[model samples]
Target: MDVAEILSHHILDHHWGYSLGGVELPITTHTVTLLSVSVIMLIGLYWISKGGASTLKRLLTAGAEEYVTFIRDGMVLPNMGTEGKSFLPYFCTLFLFILLTNLAGLIPNMKTATSNISVNAALALCSGGLIVYCGLKFHGIIGFLKGFIPSGTPGWLVPLIFPLEVISLIIKVCVLALRLFANMLAGHMVLISLLLMIFIIGQLSAVAGVGAAIPAMGLEIFMTCLELLVAFLQAYVFTLLTAIFAGSVIHTH
Candidate 1:
């Protein structure tokens, strides 16, 4: 069996059809999953904000708001400070969108969108853009550019340090993208490899396949549970780091 081909079937984008946009583009599985996640989040936000009248509805809404509150109180306020309150919605949306997409992968026959580097990079770009915006908003263009150089730096070192700082900013975004994509991809790869072993061994001998099945299934189950936790953890980590980075820029000297 071609292991690489199997992995790509699961990991790579599966195009369902071509969309006639400004240019023809293949609409892939991730596109549908992401759009679904977006719709769900919007409906959830409306339900949370509307404050449904029924007792059941109210309880469910409260539970939903608790997660949103965690982002606001736990992540944003502590890291980004009260000044970051205005952007609470953006952070909340980011966390929830990621959490949903991550969780979706656990469903049978479904895949995680965040496993795609392009998707993760797009997310990082959004966060990076926000960081740049915060810098420009709080400090003017001159002040923002000057913030890269430290207060007591020597004149000669200023030029060297400035370029490094700019490069550092770009690297931060790349890191965010790579971190999420790699983490998600790694977990799924492990899980996929475990299951594939059963099929590969089965071809050699029935008895061997049966023996491998027990351990392979056990590991797959364990990985699934671990992946569930990872889904939430990755979402939180990305959101928290973004807030911290934004906070740093906002409070820069």
Candidate 2:
């Protein structure tokens, strides 16, 4: 294939080799990757919660426990405060699930679930629901609605400010979804493009391909490492923002 065709393949969605219902509802490679990752995560959870006498068992479990402790102490407790302690499990699950999915994309032949806008949107919806629920629980429905009103505002501005605040709240949730989805999608795209260049150059001329492959492949490896860090960073950013949103609404100070 030519360079354009090779690059195009990277940009397009990949399909499963075969369809279950004759294409009525085709399960794509992404779906299978997501399912596989989910199963591995569930197995990890079992090991995380279980105990064994072997040293390897203890070491693995310790790492998982440390991760849980770190998120609870570092993210949830700090942002949510003491009153929000009960929400630790919720945030922990969110962090780990997103982290796993993000890392899954780096695995050979695996797709990143978080890179899908639909998946990210669903996660944002859940966070938004929690924000609203916490706000209403801490303050009554009327009080929560009134929280949007700025202090010492003239009666004339109340009407305008109220609608604006409502819109802002919805936008906040949308930003959350887009932030995760965009980052994950863009990172993978860059990596794919970088790797595709080597193949494209080589197809045109063997010598040029070999020469281009050296730097191209080197850069691809560097980007892969950077992407790994981004995977963790993006997951942490999403969870941190979710906690902050909920905390702000719950306390309102």
Residue pairs with backbone atoms closer than 3 Å in model 1 (clashes)? none
Write model 1 residue lDDT over 26-124, tens digit each, in one string: 578888788878888888777767886899788978887797788899999998788899889889889988989999888877779999998999999
All candidates: TM-score: 0.95, 0.91
RMSD of each: 1.7, 2.1
- List runs of model 1 lying over 4 Å from the truth: 19-25
User: Largest TM-score belongs to which candidate?
Assistant: 1
Write candidate 2's Cα lDDT for 171-190 as tens digits.
99999999999898898888
